[model samples]
Target: MKRLRTSIRVKLTIATLIPLVTAIALCWVVGASIITSRFSSQALYTVETSLNSAHELFLGEQSRLSDIIRLTSRLPELAENLSTSGPTASVAPLRLLLGNEHLSFLTLVDRNGLVRYRAANPSFNGDSRIGDKIVSAALKGAVTSGITVLQAEQAGRENPQLPGKMVIRLKATPHAYTSSKTMEERGLFLVASAPVLGSDGKLLGAVYGGILINSDNRLVDRITSVVFQQGDTDARVRGNATMFLDNIRIATTVRDEQDKPAIGSLMSEEVFAAISRGTKWIGRAFVLKEHYFTAYEPLRDLAGAVVGALYVGMPERPLMQLRSQVNIIFSCVLLFLTIIGVTLSAWIGSKMTRPVRALADGARRITAGEDLPDIHVDSHDEIAELADEFNIMKHRLAIREDENRALNHTLEQKVMERTAQLEEKNQQLLAAQKELAESERLAAVGMLASGVAHEINNPLAIIRGNAELLEMTATLDNPANEEVETIIRQTDRIERIVRNLLTFSRSGIKRLSLVSLGILVDDILDQVGHQIPLDQYRIVRNYRDGEIEVEGDEGQLRQVFTNLIVNGLQAMEGGGMLTVETSLNMAQQQANITITDSGPGISAEQREKIFTPFFTTKRDGTGLGLAISYGIVTDHAGEIRINGEVGTGAVFTVVLPLRQKEVDELS
Candidate 1:
């Protein structure tokens, strides 16, 4: 049991190291799949982008060369010299057209797809026929342009000597000579055909133009530069483009170990099969025993036949090296964290046990009522916290023990002194209490008598003096207005006392009458702002239908309006707006008087019992305003409701019947 308890270091090792190992394993398992999927997708995107670019370049060359052929085919020499001067005499003009352009193949062919004039290989003007699809389409007066692979023997040149590019031409129908060489094999060429017409649009002959791509070409080199060119050599994004004829790479920028053009090399079996089936193959491929991110697109001929493939690829090594470097960094960081965690955990475990053991021993000593010394711990860890707590407890215990010893020594003297002090204080307290009792009795009687006499005699004195002053100052013709005002003020002071006592003491049966809400509200506002400045609040009056009359007691309704408006104004500190809106709801035939204030609103708890009798939130309040208001509203066959939450100020909505039909019938 001791061994198990003490082996915290081992426990920490197993606890920390296991998760690290699991994490490493998890990273190893998932990292390859994620990296491969993401990097491969990026590589394929680049390749596909390059392939589409190549297709555009190919079409551009065809279109530009087709325009040249159309312009050339309309020449008067082309139609006149074919029969009179014969086919061989036109080679100079055809070669001149090919001179200023990058065109590789330009041949004057009759409508039957027979080559009449050849610019490059002009010496072999034999009666050789061509089965080139673009030429055949041009023979039918259809201008065509496309990519096609020609056999070696058909061009009368060796495989390496073939022009590595081609394009079709456009022309009208003329004629074809019966030829002998019909089954000759040819190398790859992109060709264009255009119909040649006389000045009057009559079919004359068709012109065929082509560029050879069966050898290393500048077109593919430029494509490679444009698509995958990057500045970094160490992490270079190396790319190669190829013109593939079905399975064989006819012309490519892909290089062999001898730094020769990797021409005539076969595409991978998988890529070839997919391309043969007209599928675009984009994935990782092993070319020249090195992996590449390759994209292959099926090349279609003039007749829309799948004849070859266009390919673009970036070397896979750089991407792989990037992944490997990332993996190495991750492993180094993981190892560093694991080592740090294990070292920290081990140090903590070793340091922890000693303090815990010391604390346990100290706790045992404390249980036996033995003195304990301070426990010292320097590390900033949980173990140090525990030690600190123990030290604090030990210090408190020492203080208590010292107090106990001192208390034991001074107990008898303390009792004697305390008893003497208590007796003295008791006699003094007894005399003080008797005098205090007499004072309290006299204070209570004096306060009551004084308060009653002051309250009653002051008002009576004011009334008597004001009356005497009025009597003395009055004249038959002229009355002293100041003396009359003093009399009126004294009477009002006495009336206020009576009013406060009588209000809400007993619920008075309200007298109902036809009342205009606007008139009642106006009267209350004029009376209430006597002390307060009315300009402190913006009074917004919105009466939807003017002069809304409700059947209610005039005095009671006035009191309700007075209480609500005063309360609303008082609720707003530093002045806020007050909205008094009246609307007659025709559907319910009730008058709604909404008195709202932009004030620090009533809370939920305050609103609940706001109308409860004698329930007030104010320091000096009668708490009878809303209660009396509620009673009056109910008696008038109306409903008074306060709507709003804590923050949105209070809205006291009084909904009263236009004519209290129920109450009126009863009356």
Candidate 2:
């Protein structure tokens, strides 16, 4: 056992080395982490910035195309030639402008989008371009310019060399989804179209010109020169740019193993997905079998559809090499410091542990039942002071050991008594909280009732008085008389609602009277049309053979049933059945009233809090109707329950004793 254990000097040496080595290791880890994160962040930012530049350059080209077409369409000589002479007469000026602008095709179309003059092939000029977005937009007096795709036949008709120039054989690529297509024949173009209006602003025709993108590396090479120009020779080719028609590359500076531009290669599947969704992808991606920090942004046509993508990528190898160099230098420096620290720590531990060894020897002797005197040391420092204090501690420790035994016993008893007292106090506190909540709820109801009654009564009185005077003066045959009666009726309904609110605020049933559930339901049903339009709802009633009477405060009971009926009507908002069923339980001498609504029923979690004060699912509910009804029913020695499941609708059932005498007897 002793052989397995290490000495204090060894422990101190290891402790000193642990933190020093840990701190050095942590420093290396943090440095490497920061460097790696910074490199990644900077790489993405650079590629994204390059992508922005490419987009601007692409837009600038489109703007230049639009400018050329605009200038050509507005020329007086060309317009006059087309308006007076044959279509062939205008072909001379169009051909001159098309060659000067280096455009692949230039043509003039009539107001119906029919080709009238073709600068490239004047004889082939009767096709309709009305189906094309650019042509359609321009013919409607708009000057539109953007990327657009042309079919192979259309390109062939415009220029005999275009179909051959647009053909590109697809090449297999790593990290790209395999496609069955072997060749891309559609031509992607930067096109601009403008309306050719006459001197009087009349639509005479339209003019459009474009440059083919497939097999043309000029645009992508220009983007590379502008974006990667600041870098060295090696870095110049490290950053590449590409233009893709969908996922297939039409033009690119990215080269394959043969050092040829990989124009027909497909983009990585992940990048294709992002571009397809009209979003930008910025991260590390494998392009042409080499990893690069790349950014791909969707290229949209004039119709705002994602027809292709634009990409810019920077090589990740250079940044990774820099990070490797930094790590190598950092590790070497830390290794040198660690070697020096280990040597110094061993020497210091040996010197400091000599006195400590002596103390250990003394303790061992005491443990072996041998009496020893005070420990002494030669050094006049804290180590020497420690020896004197150690002797005093040995003497005081014996006396304190006995005192602790008694103190521990007394502490356990006090803890038990305090725990019992805390449990009792907790119970009292819980009871107090419940009472306080109820009191606060009552106080809020009283305040709301007082404020509402004060604010609405004066205005209601004025309205009612004016309505009565109008009712007296209006003739029986007057159409407005019916509207006047409706106003007076609604005013009375508002007064009754206010009275009910004041009663609910009191939180009790003040008087008891006989209420016929069947008759009461019918009366409220007849009056509910004033509350809400009932054209969409179907009312259903199933009453017992005789009237079922209950002894309750008539006004309070009326409020309860009215609230339920109105709630049922509101719930079936899209037009469903509102069912009122009343039955007498002869065995229990209780009357049962049920109001069912074909509405989306309440869930279990909602049912738990359905009758809680200020809890409601309605958007604009005050959340007190059910709570008030619950209180009134309980005061009358009655029970109210809700039964239903989600999607089946809810049924609210209220059961009351047949008479007040029966309720008293049961209580």
Q: Using TM-score as the measure, which candidate wins? A: 2
Report the Cα RMSD per candidate. Answer: 18.5, 11.7
Off by over 4 Å in 2: 1-3, 74-77, 83-100, 109-117, 126-131, 136-142, 195-204, 235-238, 283-286, 290-292, 322-330, 358-382, 386-667
Cα lDDT tens digits for candidate 1, 1-667: 4553536667877788898878876886588668877888987887888888877876776687678877877777677555443455445677787767756667776645556677766755545345666776776787777776666565543123353232221111112112232221345676777776666776666777767766646777777767767554332247888887656656778776567666656677767778888889888876654778888889887778898888888899877787788788778877887888789888867776777778888899889988767888777888899989988988887668768778877997899999999999999999999999999888655543433332334346555755665677647334567656655765665454334324423444444578998987876565455435677788888888999888866655765777788888878878899999999899989989999999978888898899875577777655667776787687777889878877789999998888865442212
**What is the Å distance of residue 18 in model 2 from its true position?**
2.0
**TM-score for predicted model 1 compared with the true structure:** 0.49
Stretches > 4 Å off in candidate 1 = 1-6, 13-36, 83-88, 99-104, 111-115, 121-132, 157-185, 231-237, 359-667
The global Cα lDDT (0 to 1) of model 1 is 0.70
**Overall lDDT per candidate, in order of appearance:** 0.70, 0.81
lDDT of 2 by residue, 1-667 (tens): 4568787667877888789878988888898889889998988999999999999988888899999988888977555655763455456778898788789999888887778888877778778889888888889988889888888898888887799999999999999978999999998999998988889888887889899999898999889889877555443348889999989999998877777888899999988988889999999987878789999999987779999999999888887787898789878988887788778878877877888888888888867867788887888888888888888877776578778868898899899999999999999999999999999897787656644453344335545654665767746566557656756665665665566556554654356667888888897787666557789999999996568788876655766787788888877768899999999898999899999999998899998998886687888676777777787787778989899999999999999988775332111
Angstrom error at residue 336, model 1 = 2.5
Error of 2 at 504 (Å): 32
Clash numbers, per candidate: 38, 0
